[model samples]
Each structure stands twice: as C-alpha cells, then as structure tokens.
Target: MKKDVRGMLKDFTDGLAAISETNKANVNAFMRLLNTGYKEGALSTKTKELMSVAIGVYNRCEYCIVYHVYKSLEAGATREEIMEAAMVAVGFGGGPSMAYSATLLKDSIDEFENDFK
Candidate 1:
C-alpha cells in the first residue's frame, strides 16, 4: 500500500513524544545525539540530511525516508539533490533502493516539498 508521508511524519512525531514519556533518559539522549549530528559542522546540515535520505532508502525505512526528506527540504536541499542521494543508495542497495527511491521517496518529496516554501 502507498504510505502517507505527511501522516507518517505526524505519527512519528507523536510516537516519539509518547515513547519519550516512558523512556525519558534514552529518548533524551537520542534526541541530543540527533541535534548534535545535524548541527552545521564539517558538512552542512543539508548534506547530512541528504546522506540520511540515501541511508534511509538503502535501509528501506519508511519513517526514515519521510522524516529525512522533510528535513532535507528544510535544510535547503533541492529535489534534484535528494534524488541524487537516493540514486547513490541505489548504486549500493540495487533494486530495492531504486524501488524506494522511485516510490516512497518520490511520494515524500511530493508531499513535503511545498511545506518548506
């Protein structure tokens, strides 16, 4: 079935918050790690988010795809740049990554691209 990228993001956000209530310490640490990882460092946040998109596709994680696509856009990654990252994943992940890149990734881009504008 086709996934609702926006709804997936909302659910993920809500779920993360709920999970944090039950597992505060670990969740907080993970959140901190994410914050630190995404900060502008050796690479720009946009580059990191793009790399995340490729990793998500290669790993076939739906939530990761949606989340990182939204972040990639928020970090100022163009659709072309996102696609290029996904293609690099396809190079390593083969058919599976291509499938996701064409479907879920495309759908995510369609759903969230305008939100950043």
Candidate 2:
C-alpha cells in the first residue's frame, strides 16, 4: 500500500509527544537542545534546514524528510535549494539516497506545497 506520509508524520509526532509526556523534563531538555542547535549562529536557519534535508535524504528517513522539508520551506528554502541539498545527499549516500530523493523528497515537497496552498 502507498504511504500517507503527512498522516504518518502527524501520528508519529503525536506518539512522540505522548511518550515524552511520561518524562517531561528529559524530553523538554532534548527539545531545548534541538532548538539551540538549530537557532541562527554562523549558519542561517535556512542553511540549517537545507542541511537537514540533505541529512534526511542520506538517512532515508521519511519522517525526517517530511519534517525537514516543511521546516526548510518555513525557513524560506526554495524547491530548487531543497533539490540541490538532496543531490548532495545522493553524492554521499549513492543509490539509496538517490532513490529516496527522487521519490520521498519529491512527494514530501508536493504534499507540503499543496497543504500551504
């Protein structure tokens, strides 16, 4: 069966929140660390998001890809930029990354854009 990537993401996030609630302090700390790492320093948020897209592709995590793609768009990364980042992942990860980028990345981008429109 075909996956509903957006729905799966929502469910995963909801599940994560529920799990995190059982250990709020630790989860909060981890979230804080994530926020701190992603915050603007030498690299802009958009740059970080682009990097995330590449990492997501290399890792072949659909959840990661969807989340980072949405975040990248919010951070003002154009489709072209995201695609370029995916290409970079393909360079490192070879065929697996290429497959993920061509399928999952494209689907995520289309889904995200459609939702916003």
Candidate 3:
C-alpha cells in the first residue's frame, strides 16, 4: 500500500483536530451528526458500521474507508462481514468501488482486523 493504513488514520485524526480548532461550529456539528449516525438505533451499531464501510468504499473516500473498517471491527463485525459489505458496494458502485474494495479496504482490514482481537 502507498500509505500505511494506520498512518492514514492518525493523519486524519490530526487533520480533523486542526480543522476543529478553527472550524469549531461546523466541526462540532459534523461530529454530532457522525456520533448520532453511528449510535445504535433500529440497526445495531455493528450493522451501521458495516453499512458505513460500504458507503465509504462506494464514495471512494480513503479516510472514511479506513475509519469505518476499523470501527466495524471494533463494533464486532467479522472480516467476512466487512468484505461482504464492501462487495455490496461494488455491486452498486461497479469497478471504481471494486478497486477501492480490493485495494484500500483490503489493506485497511489487514492493518486493523487483528487489533480488534
């Protein structure tokens, strides 16, 4: 992988923090929305995280893919479950999504899957 998945996560975290320093209102709103979205609802948190993984892949958002993959595992999704979600994205998103699923998503799993165990 061109970028280490863990490093990408760290960088994203740092970047978010820096942005939050200046863009506090928007950042706080975004964080609230994120927390609300990820909170358990009709769907379990694990299911939500899996859905996020698929959405991230479909959108080709590298940082989102890394974050949600890690969160999915943390929420107790198995590697297989994560992959299945990514495949669902590929179905909708076609080759562009597949490319991310095959590359960045796979790398994110490799880098973070064991961390949950």
Best by lDDT: 1
Q: What's the CA RMSD of model 1 in angstroms?
A: 0.7
- Cα lDDT of all candidates, in order? 0.96, 0.87, 0.94
Q: By TM-score, rank the candidates, best first.
A: 1, 3, 2
- For candidate 2, lDDT tens digit of each residue in 1-117? 346778867986897799897988888898898799899999999999999999999999888998898888888888889999999999999999999888888888877865544
Cand. 1 Cα-lDDT: 0.96
Tell how far residue 30 is off in model 1, in angstroms.
0.2
In candidate 2, stretches whose alpha carbon ends up further than 4 angstroms from where it belongs are: 114-117
How good is model 1 by TM-score?
A: 0.98
**Candidate achieving the largest TM-score:** 1
Better of 1 and 3 by lDDT: 1
Candidate 3 global lDDT: 0.94
Which residue pairs does candidate 2 place in steric collision? none
